[model samples]
Target: MSGRLQHKVAIVTGSGSGIGLESSLLFASEGANVVLADVNLPSAQKGADLIKDRYPTVKGIAVKCDVGKEEDVKAVVDLAVREFGRLDVMFNNAGIMHPEDDNALNTEDRIWDLTMRINVKGVWWGSKYAVLAMRQNPTDEAKGLHVGGSIINTASFVAVVGSATPQIAYTASKGAVLTMSRELAMVHAREGIRVNSLCPGPLKTPLLMDFLNTDEKKQRRLVHLPMGRFGEAIEQAKAALFLASDESSYVTGTDFMVDGGLTNAYVTSIGEPTLPPPSSLI
Candidate 1:
């Protein structure tokens, strides 16, 4: 498992915190030089600093990037090439689910537009520049490098299944992400690049918890989560690592769900144990 991404260079957007930060740390541990891009300069720098202090051998740089901006995304990719000489993984993990993103009727035009810009358009920009960089630095087989790279888009289970608690804009944006990933995968499949959508269920990230202030609100969200708990960022990072590494070389145009069975559950377990206790408990 060590050095699964040895000698690779990766850019993880929204790396200040949540899944983005966790994945950047994991990728560095596996021997990839990482660029932590975030709109928050100080936060991105802190994340990069953590990696540099811990994984001294790997190069970690913090770049101020707004993924929603094409120029900013392009700069992030260019930074990876300028600093590391090549790009191998592009993790489009930056997104938003605002309080204002409820139902089409209630959600404002501004909120909807912002959500689409960051969640959907951001991925488009990241993929656009990453593909160009990856193609230019195609695998050097003699040097033990592969022929192409991996692109991981952070989608959500909401894209696959409908929810009564509607975040209309967020859900629709993610739907775009799922379909866009598939189309891009097909376009690049013959070119040696593999594209995939990593759909996470309810997570304990700040993005989710910030909205769930009360225990009642939390319980309402957890009712559908079969695990009876929200997923940790590190858990999702492991899945991203698999996609970034050569282990999933043949995987493309797929919706990889790491949802803790939430999506599979029709009626999740009730408050307590659903079945009788074992004899040992008795």
Candidate 2:
């Protein structure tokens, strides 16, 4: 059977690991040629290599991109178009949660600037350039392609609700992403281009796991999560795939929350659900 993203081309930033890498692999599996953009060239190349080995029919390329820089973000989009013939999806997933990020009074200016550069400005640059390339897409009736693309910006559940955990800079940056995506979606909706923010809750990715290092830290956030478990990268990847594919063609300017009931939580349950059989934790 044909894949959902057959004949499409996608760009996934921060593809060295975490949600970006998983989304890259999943996009390739769905038959889209993917451009893995990350500052860590080796990790991005590894993702490309995996695509080459596992999905022989599709193509994957690694581009060293510091998403904070507009030029770097532009280069990745240009590379995708030059190599794959068109751009279909832009997954702006690169971001930084600086270790020093804390409450407004505790955080330094440099930390706030650094976080904004990568987390907020990166998405801005990615969307700006992706829209330019998407506008140039030639309609191909045979391929079921059009002169438009999907932009999935990685926001967070914190963007919608306040967190007692602080990380004020990170929270502010994510809120910017949501608003930026909404505005971009409105501007490009008539042109067939779609922009949506992918708001994932507390995830089991390095970005979160590294921050919630201690058991106390982990449980503090867990108590508020109605699902009682951190989300996996794969779960977010699947949500992204839906947004990237034509399935979400009409779904633009929306904050697509993949959070496991974190935003809807009031009080916590007493215990976690039983894990399925053969769980590694068992």
TM-score per prediction, in order, is 0.94, 0.95
- Please, what are the lDDT tens digits per residue for candidate 1 over residues 36-147? 9999989999989999899999988999999888899999999899888889999999999888778879999999999999999999999999899988885667555765
lDDT of each: 0.91, 0.93
Best by lDDT: 2
| Poorly placed runs, candidate 2 (over 4 Å) | 272-282
Candidate 2 lDDT over residue span 1-282, tens digit each: 158999999999999999999999999999999999999999999999999999999999998999989999999999999997899999999999877889989999999999999999999999999999999998899988999999999999999996658799999999999999999999999999999999999999998888887898888898888888999999999999999999888899999999899888875864955555685765
**Residue 187 displacement (Å), model 2:** 0.6
* Collision count for each candidate, in order: 0, 0
Candidate 2, pairs of clashing residues: none
